[model samples]
Target: MSYSNNAVKVFTVDPLNWQPWVETVDVKALTPAQIDVLSEAPGGLEKIGPYYALLAHDPEVLRERTRLFNAVMYGRGGLPRRERELASVAGSRVNGCTYCASVHGRIYNDLTKRTDVIQRIFTEGVDAQLEPRERAVVDFSVALTRSPERVTADDLQPLRDAGLSEAEILDLIHVVAMFAWANRLLQTLGHPTRDEVVLV
Candidate 1:
């Protein structure tokens, strides 16, 4: 799919399957003043790097919030990286963030060496093919993303049955919830993809 000159192209997916709300931003167009402002912001230089430079008009608070959110989601989780990526992928899939799904899908495949499963979830539905634990994580993520209000004790059962500890389950929920917010924020603010950044 062709994007605007200022847009970053990350993943090419069937728009009919996963519909993302916003096109990716192109960081190459950022001005020096924007870069200077972003570089000085807390965690801004690292969490988003040059991408934050593209969002020159964005409030500093929003930039810092996104940076902090990503840091926690990708960094502090005690769960296995594979498991965390699974939940992230599943949540992105449910949230219809094609960019996030593709990025996390690659990470999941790399970590688990399970490209087949990753492809299956991306092409088909998450329920199409997954192990017991994987299925539980996918289900929980989907439920949490789609209709969080509908989540009840029954929703946690599968995760519990899959032998996930309370901490893991909580972590899964937090990741899903955080990503849900992050996806919307990125969509609303038109966050740039990694491809958009121009390394200095």
Candidate 2:
């Protein structure tokens, strides 16, 4: 399904405008009691801003998961910030998540100042016009996201050859994997993209 121009606008605004044809759950507008129920559920709603109220019900577990995800993305992971963003964009592209593709494409463009590269990755494929290292990262991300069962030592060797350490390679894999999960969730839940919001 194609995204409407206003679909993204919903995420840009505080109060979401639910579409008439789209039957979606508005996590942002839940009542206090509804928030409590979400907090008690498996995927704590607290990670997303609209669901923050759920923290009142179960702060500890939600906090721990958020912390670990943050650490993996920003702390101990040796993968460079730009590379991580590239991996995220690549995975989101393969998953057909326009929202995530736009978000991470903007990030990659801002950091690398390579709009051409971003355009190619989005319009063409991840393997379109990347350097060896960038190509390795994109290839690895696509492989891990699309067909993890097919991944082997040979699949990882190129990333190693591209100068990424084992830890950094694993970090890249984690970022790709996480985004795969995130892309599915956001797409399934009909989360809209706010690409015009300059995150940089």
Candidate 3:
């Protein structure tokens, strides 16, 4: 229940039951650059968890990353938040990034209140049987993540057909690509807790 970003508590099961398995950088020993970078963390990095401190090793990149991430994920327009979260889930799943999938799935559920698609994602793939619009977004996300080289402008036809405007299409692409990179970063930087454990 402690909230200090500088403490060195044993990384245990998160109350949310989705803790990062890797050790984060000690928040207290953070350099000035990292401090400055994290000071401007979007959505309050501390509230988001310890991963921001870890990524703060490269304050410049982390700043741009967080800035862009906040704008894309929490922006005013473009794909609906639910669809954006779905794209994150799709990209994370295709990239084999369990942490991103879990977190985004939770957001997807919270926003959409629909577990059927989440279950579909788990049992099948992002391209599982879905409503037409959902299927289009998932397909775009998966294809973009798995084989970016093979993807073409034509690949976005389904989303367009689903009534996504050009701006929404671009936003969806950015969200998917962002998760593709973010998922790889998370997988390489830290593992995630597999079970719930929150005694503290």
C-alpha lDDT (0 to 100) for residue 188 of candidate 1: 58
What local lDDT does model 1 show for residue 88?
A: 81
Q: Residue 138's C-alpha lDDT in candidate 2?
A: 92
Which structure is stronger by lDDT: 2 or 3? Answer: 3
Model 1 worst lDDT run, 10 consecutive residues: 12-21
**Best prediction by TM-score:** 3
lDDT of 2 by residue, 1-200 (tens): 34455465211112232222233235667656556555554456654332233233344554555555566567743999889888988898888766667767777778888787777886677669888999999999999989999999999999989999988987998898779766775576454543332111
Model 2: CA > 4 A from native: 1-65, 191-200
- lDDT (CA) per prediction: 0.65, 0.67, 0.75
Report how far residue 65 has shifted in candidate 1, in Å: 2.4
For model 3, residues 1-36, the per-residue Cα lDDT tens digits are 322332222321122233444556667677787777
Off by over 4 Å in 1: 1-37, 40-51, 54-56, 189-200
Models sorted by TM-score, best on top: 3, 1, 2
Model 3: weakest 10-residue lDDT segment is 6-15
Q: Supply the TM-score for candidate 2.
A: 0.69
